[model samples]
Target: MLKSLITAIRTLTLFSVPGRDTESFSNTLFWFPVVGLFLGLLQALFGYGAHLSGWNELAAALVVLGGVVLTRGMHLDGLADLCDGFWGGRTKESILRIMKDPNVGSFGAIALSMHLLLKWIAVLKLVELGAFTFIAAGVLLARLTQVVLASALPYARREGGTAQAFVTGAGWMHISVASLFTLLFLFPLLHQDLHALLALLAASIAAGGMTGLLSYKKIEGVTGDVLGAASELTEVFVWISGALYLLLSGNG
Candidate 1:
């Protein structure tokens, strides 16, 4: 268990776990949980601390910005690419072509703006509801979405890169292990609310499934970028769902 965790950390973060090298694609599968947990914890700390500190919306936004910087905007870049692809082209092939290009298109710019705006609004809503746990879960599950993509799809690229290494070694077992840990962390926050728990789980499953299908139809297969985009977008969906639930249930 310790080894797996260390492997996961090495793959996900800047941390160099003993003998692990980031350049090797084989170690990518091991990092999913590590990254997910780390990012999740950070977001939790940020939200909880901000709320406790009586920080306003701007301060809360800074916490999220801190997270984005910590992750080096890796997922955001993918989100932009996905946005460009989905909106720029009429055909699937044309979309893929735009995604492959390093340049950001107009669609990408618009998408990035909307994503950032939505994330800020979502975070603000959670803060308003005092739902720190949901904010943390959103962060965790976003990264977990990446793990699911890594586990389920093949990398599009041939020569080994970050995506290749991860997709190559990831199996159902890795996803299961990551998911087990994710659920454990989430269980504490559910506070015995079986209905809310089930709702969140169903939402996550549906979001992931939809992303997977989209990846297959548009990209032919899932690449690292696709996986990253899936993580961020799924988190957005989960956040919206959680906010709505809290608002409607009078729990927020």
Candidate 2:
């Protein structure tokens, strides 16, 4: 269990876990959300502490930058690669080929720009509303969405890839367990505001589902980039939903 937790941390964050990774991806799956919980907590702390100490805009920017730094910007990079491939390629073969390229194209650059802008806008609104928990929830839901994506689709590459080990043998049990842990952790942070909590969950499901469906249609399966894209989209939707709720409730 400890090893699994370490593996999960090592996989999800830049944290230096002392031990080696667990060989089986499923063995490390149980702690995915736990790793997310740690990230969310740190993000919430960064946002909240900044909110208390600095300007709202500063807090928002700091939290946004902090999250990217924490995860090494892997999710955003994945989203960029997906944008370049999904929009630029003429066929599945071309799409995969485009995505594998190390260089970012026009599509990828625009996608990254839009993603960061939208994220900053949403985070600013949440910070102004004193909704730091929503920031944490957004990050947590992002990771949870990745678990579902891994379970729902086959690895797109026939030759396999870095994420193949995690996605190939995933099943419902993996989703259910990861989800259970995710929701349990969320309940405490989100329980007081049922509407926001429900909205967050619904938005996460919608985001992940749409991402998976798009991947299936475009490439017939998923890759690490698709999973990253899903994670990035899920977090964006989660934040948008929270902000929308606050607006509708006259809290924003």
The clash numbers for all candidates, in the given order, read 3, 0
lDDT of each residue in 120-238, candidate 1, tens digit only: 88878888788777777777777677778877887765444556766777778778877887787788776767777777777777777887888777766777678778877877787
- lDDT of all predictions: 0.73, 0.89
RMSD to the true structure for each prediction, in A, is 2.7, 1.1
Candidate 1 shows a clash count of 3
Query: How high is each candidate's TM-score?
Result: 0.86, 0.97
Tell me the deviation in Å of residue 59 in model 2: 0.5
TM-score of 2: 0.97
Q: Which stretches of candidate 1 lie over 4 Å from their true place?
A: 1-7, 14-19, 22-31, 89-97, 158-161
The superposed Cα distance between candidate 1 and the true structure at residue 244, in angstroms, equals: 0.9
Q: After superposition, how far is residue 234 of candidate 2 from its true place, in Å?
A: 0.6
